[model samples]
Target: MAKTIAVEYRVHDGPDALAHAAAEHFLEQAQKSVAAKGKARIAVSGGSTPKRTFELLANPKEKFLQAMPWEKLELYFVDERTVPPTDKDSNYRMTREAMLDKVPLKPEQVFRIKGELPPEEAAARYESTLRNQFKLEGAEVPRFDVLALGMGDDGHTASIFPHTAGIHELARLVYANQVPQKDTWRVTLTWPVIIQAGEVFFLIGGKDKADPLHRVLQGQYDPETLPSQLIQPKNGKLLFLLDKDAAALLPAPDASGKGKLEIQR
Candidate 1:
Protein backbone atom coordinates (compact mmCIF):
# COMPACT_ATOMS: atom_id res chain seq x y z
CA MET A 1 0.00 0.00 0.00
CA ALA A 2 1.19 3.50 -0.82
CA LYS A 3 1.63 5.94 2.03
CA THR A 4 0.32 9.49 2.10
CA ILE A 5 2.88 12.27 1.82
CA ALA A 6 2.41 15.88 2.75
CA VAL A 7 4.19 18.04 0.21
CA GLU A 8 5.02 21.64 0.96
CA TYR A 9 5.92 24.07 -1.79
CA ARG A 10 6.84 27.71 -2.12
CA VAL A 11 6.45 29.72 -5.30
CA HIS A 12 8.73 32.62 -6.05
CA ASP A 13 8.07 35.62 -8.24
CA GLY A 14 10.77 34.73 -10.72
CA PRO A 15 13.98 32.86 -11.34
CA ASP A 16 16.12 35.07 -9.13
CA ALA A 17 13.72 34.76 -6.23
CA LEU A 18 13.52 31.03 -6.75
CA ALA A 19 17.27 30.74 -6.62
CA HIS A 20 17.43 32.80 -3.46
CA ALA A 21 14.84 30.57 -1.81
CA ALA A 22 16.77 27.46 -2.79
CA ALA A 23 20.02 28.87 -1.52
CA GLU A 24 18.43 29.77 1.78
CA HIS A 25 16.94 26.31 2.06
CA PHE A 26 20.32 24.76 1.38
CA LEU A 27 22.00 26.84 4.07
CA GLU A 28 19.24 26.15 6.57
CA GLN A 29 19.43 22.41 5.99
CA ALA A 30 23.19 22.42 6.27
CA GLN A 31 23.10 24.37 9.53
CA LYS A 32 20.41 22.12 10.98
CA SER A 33 22.36 19.01 10.04
CA VAL A 34 25.60 20.42 11.46
CA ALA A 35 23.83 21.28 14.70
CA ALA A 36 22.32 17.81 14.97
CA LYS A 37 25.38 15.91 13.82
CA GLY A 38 28.94 17.14 13.51
CA LYS A 39 28.85 17.60 9.75
CA ALA A 40 26.42 17.94 6.85
CA ARG A 41 26.31 15.60 3.85
CA ILE A 42 24.26 16.86 0.93
CA ALA A 43 23.64 15.59 -2.60
CA VAL A 44 22.75 18.09 -5.30
CA SER A 45 21.37 17.76 -8.81
CA GLY A 46 22.50 19.93 -11.70
CA GLY A 47 20.25 22.29 -13.68
CA SER A 48 19.78 25.96 -14.44
CA THR A 49 17.91 26.64 -11.19
CA PRO A 50 20.45 24.75 -9.11
CA LYS A 51 23.28 26.48 -10.91
CA ARG A 52 21.78 29.83 -9.99
CA THR A 53 21.41 28.69 -6.39
CA PHE A 54 25.02 27.56 -6.31
CA GLU A 55 26.17 30.88 -7.67
CA LEU A 56 24.14 32.64 -5.01
CA LEU A 57 25.75 30.49 -2.34
CA ALA A 58 29.20 31.33 -3.67
CA ASN A 59 28.62 35.01 -4.28
CA PRO A 60 30.39 37.32 -1.84
CA LYS A 61 27.49 39.73 -1.93
CA GLU A 62 25.10 37.09 -0.71
CA LYS A 63 24.84 36.16 2.96
CA PHE A 64 24.87 32.45 2.04
CA LEU A 65 28.49 32.64 0.95
CA GLN A 66 29.61 33.68 4.42
CA ALA A 67 26.95 31.79 6.35
CA MET A 68 27.63 28.42 4.72
CA PRO A 69 29.84 26.15 6.79
CA TRP A 70 32.02 24.94 3.93
CA GLU A 71 34.46 23.07 6.11
CA LYS A 72 31.80 21.00 7.79
CA LEU A 73 29.94 20.13 4.58
CA GLU A 74 30.38 17.15 2.30
CA LEU A 75 28.89 17.63 -1.14
CA TYR A 76 27.77 14.89 -3.54
CA PHE A 77 26.08 14.73 -6.91
CA VAL A 78 22.67 13.20 -7.60
CA ASP A 79 23.54 12.30 -11.19
CA GLU A 80 26.05 12.86 -13.94
CA ARG A 81 26.09 12.67 -17.72
CA THR A 82 28.42 10.25 -19.44
CA VAL A 83 31.09 12.80 -20.18
CA PRO A 84 34.39 13.93 -18.75
CA PRO A 85 34.30 16.21 -15.74
CA THR A 86 35.74 18.98 -17.89
CA ASP A 87 33.16 18.55 -20.62
CA LYS A 88 30.58 21.27 -21.14
CA ASP A 89 27.75 18.83 -20.51
CA SER A 90 29.23 17.52 -17.29
CA ASN A 91 27.41 18.43 -14.08
CA TYR A 92 30.71 18.54 -12.22
CA ARG A 93 31.99 21.15 -14.62
CA MET A 94 28.86 23.25 -14.14
CA THR A 95 29.10 23.07 -10.36
CA ARG A 96 32.84 23.90 -10.41
CA GLU A 97 32.26 26.90 -12.63
CA ALA A 98 29.29 28.08 -10.59
CA MET A 99 30.25 27.41 -6.97
CA LEU A 100 32.89 24.76 -6.21
CA ASP A 101 35.80 26.81 -7.52
CA LYS A 102 34.72 29.85 -5.55
CA VAL A 103 33.78 28.04 -2.32
CA PRO A 104 36.27 27.31 0.47
CA LEU A 105 35.39 23.62 0.47
CA LYS A 106 38.36 21.31 0.05
CA PRO A 107 38.65 18.90 -2.88
CA GLU A 108 38.15 15.86 -0.64
CA GLN A 109 34.80 17.24 0.48
CA VAL A 110 33.31 17.04 -3.04
CA PHE A 111 32.53 13.51 -4.17
CA ARG A 112 31.88 13.70 -7.90
CA ILE A 113 30.64 10.82 -10.01
CA LYS A 114 33.31 9.86 -12.53
CA GLY A 115 31.24 10.33 -15.66
CA GLU A 116 34.24 9.78 -17.90
CA LEU A 117 34.35 6.12 -16.95
CA PRO A 118 32.13 3.48 -18.54
CA PRO A 119 28.54 3.78 -17.38
CA GLU A 120 28.38 0.59 -15.32
CA GLU A 121 31.85 1.12 -13.90
CA ALA A 122 31.04 4.67 -12.89
CA ALA A 123 27.88 3.58 -11.10
CA ALA A 124 29.77 0.78 -9.35
CA ARG A 125 32.52 3.16 -8.26
CA TYR A 126 29.99 5.67 -6.93
CA GLU A 127 28.16 2.93 -5.04
CA SER A 128 31.43 1.79 -3.52
CA THR A 129 32.30 5.32 -2.53
CA LEU A 130 28.96 5.72 -0.77
CA ARG A 131 29.36 2.42 1.04
CA ASN A 132 32.83 3.33 2.22
CA GLN A 133 31.93 6.86 3.16
CA PHE A 134 28.76 5.88 5.02
CA LYS A 135 30.36 2.70 6.40
CA LEU A 136 27.35 0.61 5.50
CA GLU A 137 27.36 -2.82 7.11
CA GLY A 138 24.64 -4.89 5.45
CA ALA A 139 21.95 -3.22 3.35
CA GLU A 140 22.25 0.13 5.02
CA VAL A 141 21.68 3.22 2.92
CA PRO A 142 23.34 6.56 3.46
CA ARG A 143 20.96 9.10 4.95
CA PHE A 144 22.22 12.34 3.48
CA ASP A 145 21.41 15.42 5.52
CA VAL A 146 19.87 16.96 2.41
CA LEU A 147 19.18 15.85 -1.14
CA ALA A 148 18.42 18.49 -3.73
CA LEU A 149 16.74 17.45 -6.97
CA GLY A 150 15.40 18.84 -10.26
CA MET A 151 12.49 17.79 -12.43
CA GLY A 152 12.58 17.38 -16.18
CA ASP A 153 9.86 18.59 -18.51
CA ASP A 154 8.94 14.94 -18.88
CA GLY A 155 8.40 14.44 -15.16
CA HIS A 156 11.72 12.65 -14.71
CA THR A 157 14.19 13.31 -11.91
CA ALA A 158 17.78 12.27 -11.20
CA SER A 159 18.29 10.86 -14.69
CA ILE A 160 15.55 8.30 -14.15
CA PHE A 161 13.82 8.74 -17.45
CA PRO A 162 10.25 7.57 -17.98
CA HIS A 163 9.99 3.79 -18.57
CA THR A 164 13.76 3.47 -18.01
CA ALA A 165 15.40 0.63 -16.16
CA GLY A 166 16.49 3.06 -13.46
CA ILE A 167 12.86 3.34 -12.35
CA HIS A 168 12.83 -0.31 -11.29
CA GLU A 169 16.07 -0.17 -9.37
CA LEU A 170 15.40 -0.90 -5.71
CA ALA A 171 18.48 -2.43 -4.14
CA ARG A 172 21.29 -0.45 -5.75
CA LEU A 173 22.35 2.86 -4.35
CA VAL A 174 23.33 4.02 -7.83
CA TYR A 175 22.42 2.95 -11.36
CA ALA A 176 23.76 3.21 -14.88
CA ASN A 177 20.73 4.23 -16.91
CA GLN A 178 20.63 3.98 -20.67
CA VAL A 179 18.25 6.59 -21.96
CA PRO A 180 17.11 5.63 -25.42
CA GLN A 181 15.23 8.85 -25.97
CA LYS A 182 18.34 10.91 -25.34
CA ASP A 183 20.67 8.38 -26.96
CA THR A 184 22.99 8.69 -23.98
CA TRP A 185 23.87 7.02 -20.70
CA ARG A 186 23.80 8.46 -17.20
CA VAL A 187 24.94 7.58 -13.74
CA THR A 188 22.33 8.36 -11.13
CA LEU A 189 21.59 7.75 -7.50
CA THR A 190 18.69 5.29 -7.48
CA TRP A 191 15.26 6.17 -6.13
CA PRO A 192 15.81 4.04 -3.06
CA VAL A 193 18.85 6.05 -2.13
CA ILE A 194 17.11 9.33 -2.89
CA ILE A 195 14.11 8.42 -0.72
CA GLN A 196 16.37 7.57 2.21
CA ALA A 197 17.69 11.11 2.51
CA GLY A 198 16.82 13.04 5.65
CA GLU A 199 15.57 16.01 3.63
CA VAL A 200 14.45 15.89 0.01
CA PHE A 201 13.47 18.85 -2.11
CA PHE A 202 13.00 19.69 -5.76
CA LEU A 203 14.05 23.02 -7.20
CA ILE A 204 12.17 23.60 -10.47
CA GLY A 205 11.50 26.56 -12.75
CA GLY A 206 10.58 27.57 -16.31
CA LYS A 207 7.26 27.62 -18.14
CA ASP A 208 8.19 24.39 -19.91
CA LYS A 209 7.90 22.56 -16.61
CA ALA A 210 4.40 23.75 -15.72
CA ASP A 211 2.42 20.81 -17.05
CA PRO A 212 4.82 18.19 -15.79
CA LEU A 213 5.00 19.74 -12.35
CA HIS A 214 1.22 19.74 -12.15
CA ARG A 215 1.00 16.11 -13.21
CA VAL A 216 3.76 15.04 -10.87
CA LEU A 217 2.15 16.59 -7.82
CA GLN A 218 -1.56 16.56 -8.63
CA GLY A 219 -1.99 13.75 -11.13
CA GLN A 220 -2.09 9.99 -10.77
CA TYR A 221 0.67 7.91 -9.17
CA ASP A 222 2.24 6.25 -12.18
CA PRO A 223 5.96 6.18 -11.51
CA GLU A 224 6.62 4.18 -14.68
CA THR A 225 5.37 7.13 -16.67
CA LEU A 226 6.34 9.87 -14.29
CA PRO A 227 9.52 8.85 -12.59
CA SER A 228 9.47 11.90 -10.31
CA GLN A 229 6.58 10.30 -8.46
CA LEU A 230 8.94 7.58 -7.27
CA ILE A 231 10.64 10.08 -4.99
CA GLN A 232 8.61 9.55 -1.82
CA PRO A 233 11.10 10.12 0.98
CA LYS A 234 11.03 7.70 3.91
CA ASN A 235 10.53 10.69 6.18
CA GLY A 236 7.06 11.26 4.64
CA LYS A 237 7.63 14.84 3.52
CA LEU A 238 8.79 16.53 0.34
CA LEU A 239 9.56 20.10 -0.50
CA PHE A 240 9.34 22.02 -3.76
CA LEU A 241 10.72 25.43 -4.62
CA LEU A 242 9.30 26.79 -7.81
CA ASP A 243 9.15 29.90 -9.88
CA LYS A 244 5.72 31.32 -10.75
CA ASP A 245 5.82 29.86 -14.25
CA ALA A 246 6.35 26.32 -13.10
CA ALA A 247 3.80 26.64 -10.34
CA ALA A 248 1.11 28.01 -12.64
CA LEU A 249 -0.70 24.74 -13.13
CA LEU A 250 -0.68 23.77 -9.48
CA PRO A 251 -2.99 25.03 -6.80
CA ALA A 252 -2.71 28.74 -6.22
CA PRO A 253 -0.37 29.76 -3.43
CA ASP A 254 -1.33 32.04 -0.60
CA ALA A 255 -0.12 35.64 -0.35
CA SER A 256 2.94 34.29 1.45
CA GLY A 257 3.73 32.16 -1.65
CA LYS A 258 3.21 28.95 0.23
CA GLY A 259 1.03 25.95 -0.69
CA LYS A 260 0.59 22.47 0.71
CA LEU A 261 -0.88 19.21 -0.64
CA GLU A 262 -1.28 15.65 0.49
CA ILE A 263 -0.57 12.94 -2.07
CA GLN A 264 -0.26 9.19 -1.97
CA ARG A 265 3.08 7.65 -2.70
Candidate 2:
Protein backbone atom coordinates (compact mmCIF):
# COMPACT_ATOMS: atom_id res chain seq x y z
CA MET A 1 0.00 0.00 0.00
CA ALA A 2 1.12 3.57 -0.64
CA LYS A 3 2.26 5.42 2.46
CA THR A 4 -0.51 7.76 3.60
CA ILE A 5 0.00 11.51 3.98
CA ALA A 6 0.14 12.79 7.54
CA VAL A 7 -1.83 16.03 7.83
CA GLU A 8 -3.54 17.76 10.76
CA TYR A 9 -6.50 19.98 9.92
CA ARG A 10 -8.70 22.64 11.52
CA VAL A 11 -11.82 23.44 9.52
CA HIS A 12 -13.96 26.52 10.08
CA ASP A 13 -17.39 27.24 8.66
CA GLY A 14 -16.07 30.53 7.30
CA PRO A 15 -12.97 32.62 6.71
CA ASP A 16 -13.38 34.99 9.65
CA ALA A 17 -13.62 32.14 12.09
CA LEU A 18 -10.69 30.41 10.50
CA ALA A 19 -8.64 33.62 10.49
CA HIS A 20 -9.31 34.30 14.17
CA ALA A 21 -8.39 30.76 15.12
CA ALA A 22 -5.37 30.80 12.88
CA ALA A 23 -4.14 34.11 14.24
CA GLU A 24 -4.53 32.96 17.82
CA HIS A 25 -2.89 29.63 17.04
CA PHE A 26 -0.03 31.30 15.22
CA LEU A 27 0.65 33.68 18.08
CA GLU A 28 0.56 30.86 20.59
CA GLN A 29 3.04 28.77 18.62
CA ALA A 30 5.22 31.76 17.83
CA GLN A 31 5.21 32.80 21.47
CA LYS A 32 6.13 29.35 22.69
CA SER A 33 8.89 29.03 20.12
CA VAL A 34 10.28 32.42 21.03
CA ALA A 35 10.06 31.62 24.72
CA ALA A 36 12.26 28.58 24.21
CA LYS A 37 14.58 29.80 21.45
CA GLY A 38 14.64 33.53 22.33
CA LYS A 39 13.46 34.40 18.81
CA ALA A 40 10.91 33.40 16.17
CA ARG A 41 11.88 33.44 12.52
CA ILE A 42 8.91 33.16 10.19
CA ALA A 43 8.50 33.33 6.43
CA VAL A 44 5.00 34.55 5.69
CA SER A 45 2.82 34.07 2.62
CA GLY A 46 1.08 36.47 0.27
CA GLY A 47 -2.60 36.63 -0.90
CA SER A 48 -5.90 37.24 0.84
CA THR A 49 -5.50 34.49 3.43
CA PRO A 50 -2.46 36.10 5.03
CA LYS A 51 -4.10 39.49 4.70
CA ARG A 52 -7.00 38.22 6.80
CA THR A 53 -4.65 36.68 9.38
CA PHE A 54 -2.62 39.86 9.62
CA GLU A 55 -5.69 42.02 9.91
CA LEU A 56 -6.92 39.85 12.74
CA LEU A 57 -3.60 40.16 14.53
CA ALA A 58 -3.56 43.90 13.90
CA ASN A 59 -6.93 44.44 15.50
CA PRO A 60 -6.24 47.22 18.01
CA LYS A 61 -8.65 45.57 20.44
CA GLU A 62 -6.41 42.54 20.81
CA LYS A 63 -4.49 43.04 24.07
CA PHE A 64 -2.52 39.92 23.34
CA LEU A 65 -0.44 41.81 20.80
CA GLN A 66 0.72 44.17 23.51
CA ALA A 67 1.79 41.30 25.75
CA MET A 68 3.61 39.31 23.08
CA PRO A 69 7.23 40.04 22.19
CA TRP A 70 6.99 41.47 18.71
CA GLU A 71 10.63 42.50 18.69
CA LYS A 72 11.68 38.88 18.94
CA LEU A 73 9.84 37.93 15.74
CA GLU A 74 11.81 38.17 12.51
CA LEU A 75 9.39 38.46 9.59
CA TYR A 76 10.23 37.48 6.02
CA PHE A 77 8.19 36.98 2.89
CA VAL A 78 7.52 33.57 1.32
CA ASP A 79 7.28 35.28 -2.07
CA GLU A 80 6.93 38.64 -3.77
CA ARG A 81 5.09 39.59 -6.91
CA THR A 82 7.36 41.81 -8.99
CA VAL A 83 6.27 45.30 -7.98
CA PRO A 84 7.22 48.24 -5.82
CA PRO A 85 6.55 48.11 -2.10
CA THR A 86 3.69 50.59 -2.49
CA ASP A 87 2.20 48.81 -5.48
CA LYS A 88 -1.08 46.94 -5.08
CA ASP A 89 0.61 43.73 -6.20
CA SER A 90 3.29 43.90 -3.55
CA ASN A 91 2.98 41.40 -0.71
CA TYR A 92 5.56 43.39 1.21
CA ARG A 93 3.22 46.33 1.39
CA MET A 94 0.18 44.23 2.30
CA THR A 95 1.94 42.59 5.25
CA ARG A 96 3.28 45.90 6.54
CA GLU A 97 -0.03 47.67 6.33
CA ALA A 98 -1.87 44.74 7.88
CA MET A 99 0.41 43.58 10.74
CA LEU A 100 3.69 45.48 11.10
CA ASP A 101 2.05 48.90 11.35
CA LYS A 102 -0.06 48.14 14.40
CA VAL A 103 2.41 45.89 16.16
CA PRO A 104 5.59 47.27 17.69
CA LEU A 105 7.66 44.93 15.54
CA LYS A 106 10.97 46.70 15.05
CA PRO A 107 11.78 47.92 11.53
CA GLU A 108 14.99 45.93 11.48
CA GLN A 109 13.13 42.69 12.11
CA VAL A 110 11.09 43.08 8.90
CA PHE A 111 13.00 41.69 5.94
CA ARG A 112 11.16 42.59 2.73
CA ILE A 113 11.62 41.38 -0.81
CA LYS A 114 12.90 44.20 -2.98
CA GLY A 115 10.51 43.64 -5.82
CA GLU A 116 11.04 47.19 -7.04
CA LEU A 117 14.39 46.30 -8.51
CA PRO A 118 14.90 44.44 -11.77
CA PRO A 119 13.85 40.82 -11.28
CA GLU A 120 17.32 39.30 -11.47
CA GLU A 121 18.84 41.99 -9.30
CA ALA A 122 16.03 41.71 -6.78
CA ALA A 123 16.52 37.97 -6.46
CA ALA A 124 20.30 38.28 -6.14
CA ARG A 125 20.17 41.03 -3.53
CA TYR A 126 17.46 39.29 -1.56
CA GLU A 127 19.39 36.02 -1.62
CA SER A 128 22.57 37.73 -0.43
CA THR A 129 20.65 39.56 2.29
CA LEU A 130 19.09 36.30 3.48
CA ARG A 131 22.49 34.61 3.66
CA ASN A 132 24.03 37.49 5.60
CA GLN A 133 21.13 38.03 7.99
CA PHE A 134 20.85 34.35 8.81
CA LYS A 135 24.65 34.18 8.93
CA LEU A 136 24.32 30.96 6.97
CA GLU A 137 27.84 30.03 6.09
CA GLY A 138 27.67 26.25 5.80
CA ALA A 139 23.93 25.58 5.63
CA GLU A 140 22.07 24.84 2.43
CA VAL A 141 19.14 26.91 3.71
CA PRO A 142 18.25 28.90 6.80
CA ARG A 143 15.94 27.06 9.15
CA PHE A 144 12.85 29.15 9.91
CA ASP A 145 10.70 28.71 12.98
CA VAL A 146 7.55 28.86 10.85
CA LEU A 147 6.47 29.16 7.24
CA ALA A 148 2.90 30.34 6.60
CA LEU A 149 1.60 29.67 3.09
CA GLY A 150 -1.52 30.26 0.95
CA MET A 151 -2.75 28.36 -2.10
CA GLY A 152 -4.49 29.32 -5.35
CA ASP A 153 -7.28 27.53 -7.18
CA ASP A 154 -4.65 26.12 -9.49
CA GLY A 155 -2.75 24.73 -6.48
CA HIS A 156 -0.01 27.29 -6.75
CA THR A 157 1.78 28.11 -3.51
CA ALA A 158 3.62 31.38 -3.20
CA SER A 159 4.53 32.15 -6.84
CA ILE A 160 5.27 28.57 -7.86
CA PHE A 161 2.55 28.15 -10.46
CA PRO A 162 1.59 24.85 -12.07
CA HIS A 163 3.54 23.73 -15.17
CA THR A 164 6.19 26.38 -14.58
CA ALA A 165 9.84 25.37 -14.90
CA GLY A 166 10.45 27.05 -11.57
CA ILE A 167 8.91 24.00 -9.91
CA HIS A 168 12.05 22.01 -10.67
CA GLU A 169 14.30 24.50 -8.90
CA LEU A 170 15.16 22.69 -5.68
CA ALA A 171 18.48 24.45 -5.18
CA ARG A 172 17.89 28.19 -4.99
CA LEU A 173 16.75 30.18 -1.99
CA VAL A 174 14.81 32.48 -4.33
CA TYR A 175 14.00 32.47 -8.04
CA ALA A 176 12.87 35.04 -10.60
CA ASN A 177 10.58 33.39 -13.11
CA GLN A 178 7.52 33.79 -15.32
CA VAL A 179 4.08 32.20 -15.04
CA PRO A 180 2.97 31.99 -18.66
CA GLN A 181 -0.74 31.61 -18.13
CA LYS A 182 -0.90 34.76 -16.08
CA ASP A 183 1.84 36.40 -18.13
CA THR A 184 3.44 37.67 -14.95
CA TRP A 185 6.70 37.18 -13.04
CA ARG A 186 7.58 36.75 -9.37
CA VAL A 187 10.38 36.13 -6.93
CA THR A 188 9.78 33.17 -4.67
CA LEU A 189 11.44 31.20 -1.90
CA THR A 190 12.02 27.73 -3.35
CA TRP A 191 11.44 24.34 -1.71
CA PRO A 192 15.07 24.21 -0.57
CA VAL A 193 14.36 27.08 1.80
CA ILE A 194 10.69 26.33 2.57
CA ILE A 195 11.40 22.70 3.57
CA GLN A 196 13.81 23.89 6.26
CA ALA A 197 10.90 25.40 8.15
CA GLY A 198 10.31 23.98 11.62
CA GLU A 199 6.58 24.34 11.01
CA VAL A 200 4.68 24.97 7.76
CA PHE A 201 1.02 25.95 7.58
CA PHE A 202 -1.02 25.84 4.39
CA LEU A 203 -3.63 28.60 4.73
CA ILE A 204 -5.92 27.54 1.87
CA GLY A 205 -9.36 29.05 1.44
CA GLY A 206 -12.23 29.83 -0.98
CA LYS A 207 -14.57 27.43 -2.77
CA ASP A 208 -12.41 27.45 -5.87
CA LYS A 209 -9.47 25.74 -4.19
CA ALA A 210 -11.35 22.59 -3.15
CA ASP A 211 -10.57 20.40 -6.15
CA PRO A 212 -6.83 21.05 -6.23
CA LEU A 213 -6.54 20.73 -2.43
CA HIS A 214 -7.89 17.20 -2.70
CA ARG A 215 -5.48 16.40 -5.50
CA VAL A 216 -2.55 17.72 -3.46
CA LEU A 217 -3.49 16.00 -0.16
CA GLN A 218 -3.88 12.67 -1.97
CA GLY A 219 -0.53 12.97 -3.86
CA GLN A 220 -2.11 11.64 -7.07
CA TYR A 221 -1.70 14.98 -8.84
CA ASP A 222 1.27 15.76 -11.03
CA PRO A 223 3.68 18.39 -9.77
CA GLU A 224 3.53 20.06 -13.18
CA THR A 225 -0.24 20.11 -12.92
CA LEU A 226 -0.48 21.36 -9.37
CA PRO A 227 2.43 23.36 -7.98
CA SER A 228 1.38 22.96 -4.36
CA GLN A 229 1.65 19.17 -4.70
CA LEU A 230 5.44 19.58 -4.83
CA ILE A 231 5.34 21.23 -1.40
CA GLN A 232 5.57 18.08 0.71
CA PRO A 233 8.08 19.06 3.34
CA LYS A 234 11.00 16.69 3.73
CA ASN A 235 11.59 17.40 7.43
CA GLY A 236 9.08 19.95 8.69
CA LYS A 237 5.56 19.25 9.83
CA LEU A 238 2.56 20.35 7.69
CA LEU A 239 -0.83 21.68 8.72
CA PHE A 240 -3.80 22.56 6.55
CA LEU A 241 -5.96 25.32 8.02
CA LEU A 242 -9.07 25.32 5.86
CA ASP A 243 -12.61 26.61 5.63
CA LYS A 244 -15.52 24.16 5.15
CA ASP A 245 -16.12 24.76 1.47
CA ALA A 246 -12.52 23.85 0.67
CA ALA A 247 -12.97 20.42 2.25
CA ALA A 248 -15.68 19.30 -0.18
CA LEU A 249 -13.45 16.99 -2.21
CA LEU A 250 -11.68 15.31 0.73
CA PRO A 251 -12.82 11.92 2.00
CA ALA A 252 -13.71 11.15 5.60
CA PRO A 253 -11.15 9.39 7.81
CA ASP A 254 -11.34 5.65 7.19
CA ALA A 255 -11.64 2.88 9.84
CA SER A 256 -8.48 1.21 8.50
CA GLY A 257 -6.21 3.12 10.87
CA LYS A 258 -5.97 6.33 8.84
CA GLY A 259 -4.86 9.27 10.98
CA LYS A 260 -7.49 11.50 12.48
CA LEU A 261 -8.00 14.93 10.91
CA GLU A 262 -8.15 17.26 13.88
CA ILE A 263 -10.69 20.11 13.79
CA GLN A 264 -12.12 22.82 16.08
CA ARG A 265 -14.48 25.85 16.08
Clashes of each: 0, 0
C-alpha lDDT values of all predictions: 0.95, 0.80
Maximum-lDDT candidate: 1
Q: How far off is residue 18 in model 1, in Å? A: 0.2
Estimate the lDDT of model 1: 0.95
Compared with the true structure, model 2 gives a TM-score of 0.91
lDDT of 1 by residue, 1-265 (tens): 8699999999999999999999999999999999999899999999889999999999999899899989999999999999999999999999999999999999999999999999999999999999999999778989999999999999999999998999998889999999999999999999999999999999999999999999999998898999999999999999999999999999999999999999976
Tens-place lDDT digits, model 2, residues 165-248: 689986678898788998888898887688678888888778998888887776555778888766666553478888878866
Alpha carbon lDDT at 156, candidate 1: 96
Task: List clashing residue pairs in candidate 1.
Answer: none
Q: For each candidate, what TM-score against the reference?
A: 0.99, 0.91
- CA displacement after TM-score superposition, residue 106 of candidate 2 (Å): 1.5
